[model samples]
Target: MARESFKIFYAGRNDVILYEGVEEVLESLKQKYVLGVITNGNADTKKIGIDHYFDFNISASDINAGKPEPIIFEEALRQSGFRAEEICHVGDHPVNDVEGSSDFGMKSIWFNEKELDWPLDQKPNFKEVNSWSELERTVESF
Candidate 1:
């Protein structure tokens, strides 16, 4: 048998640097909201060095489901002890984050870093944030 070289993608190998002002904004929001993370990616917050900021992290692995589904959001809502209306989920994906949250009866802030137009079909009018600063402002307003 011939040996074949393979590339295995390890989650921790990639850089995990926080965006500028992320820590400060997290620190401020931590004082007000019960911070939680619901991500499709397999990021180790401890390895990323931002685990301290989040009260809880609900990954796909944790719930056997990912975004665009109410299960994960419901789990976070349960953990948060807040009404669905009081919670705001911020995500980059239009359908998964914006539309999904709306469907689940939670507010959403869509992070559109490129300032792209809403895709015609999934044109959700959720609050759009172009930068972390904008996200912080939007979250603070809630």
Candidate 2:
């Protein structure tokens, strides 16, 4: 069936490339914070070899809800059993990741690796980091 074929292709994920220093950052952060991943994409941390670092991974497909939707964040809150204020979400997408998390009352960090401008008109209070090292420091400061 077509669905089964798609699953095979998706599971292969031959093109999944990690950014530099990702493992280092994840390793360091895992030592301190209760790390979780909330993603709209199908990037399996287990397949990517980073599963041990996170407490849980929430994907849009899992809940039938995508980012910028409160339900997705609500699910994260439910799974993590943490108050929104107690969590700091670090993501690259301005709207989906940063705004979505911020609007849901979680602190957000913009992973601006591309050096792009803040695209939104009303800038919410969020930190921006261009590198994994900077991200770690920012999270620690939270």
Candidate 3:
């Protein structure tokens, strides 16, 4: 019963707030590149008020699988009609976002919002950003 209740509560959570300047950066990026979201959690963009900005969204619920697995990344590739080299995935997670995308052949940007150190055993072989401004600059350069 507890597990079922937890599931129900989690499924109802769709209010994901964006960080400062995210909307502006996302809008800017949309003008230049195709933007999509690959999330491991429940993120209803419509409720968050950013649905119009993305080309598509792939969530764990949609695929029945999560990141660090290639299936989700492959699905994004299929839907966007872009080759692995043409796409870049940006996220905060060390393994799920950085290593996962890198292993699958897509470029990755590690958004270390909290200034956390990389895991001791896993050196990031990718770009890292501390803020959305940094990310915007990086993405614009590509």
Candidate 4:
């Protein structure tokens, strides 16, 4: 469904972790700075008109590596032509989103909208926000 020309997809492979505000957050960031998405799925970036908003995307389905592995993030930063330090990666996964972003010195902010308890083994040093408004404020202050 994603590979065909002119086809658009909203989500893929049941990746429920990416919820509503992702697009909103990205749109807000796009107004202040460059934004993008990097993942291990085949979800079409253009389905919701985010393809132009983001400069690039690195997906595990297109590469040999995935999240929690710094290479994928590295590839994303490289493809976007933006240094990792200049961007912040946000997501619901504790290990992949928080740890992976921090491992390479890129900023990380966990989207804790689900109210799950923080992981003991995976405590993050980066910012954590539960709502998109809070996330906007947090990012602005950074």
Pairs of residues clashing in candidate 1: none
Stretches > 4 Å off in candidate 3: 1-12
Residues 1-142, candidate 2: write the lDDT tens digits. 9999988888877356788888898999999889998989886888887889999999899999999899999988999999999999999999999999999999999999899999989898799999887999999888
- Backbone clash tally (model 1): 0
**Candidate 1 structure quality by residue, lDDT tens digits, 26-86:** 8888988789999887767877788899999998888899998889899988888888898
- List the candidate numbers ranked by TM-score, top first: 2, 3, 1, 4
lDDT of 3 by residue, 12-65 (tens): 686466788999999998998899999997857877789899999999789999
Q: Model 4, range 1-142, lDDT digits (tens) per residue?
A: 4465323333443334556676687677788876667887677666545687777777787889999898888887778788888878888788888888888888889988888888857566788889876888888766
TM-score of each: 0.88, 0.91, 0.89, 0.78
TM-score of 2: 0.91
Candidate 1, after superposition: displacement of residue 139 in Å?
1.4
Deviating ranges (above 4 Å) for candidate 4: 1-25
Predicted model with the maximum lDDT:
2
Residue 98: error of model 2 in Å?
A: 0.7
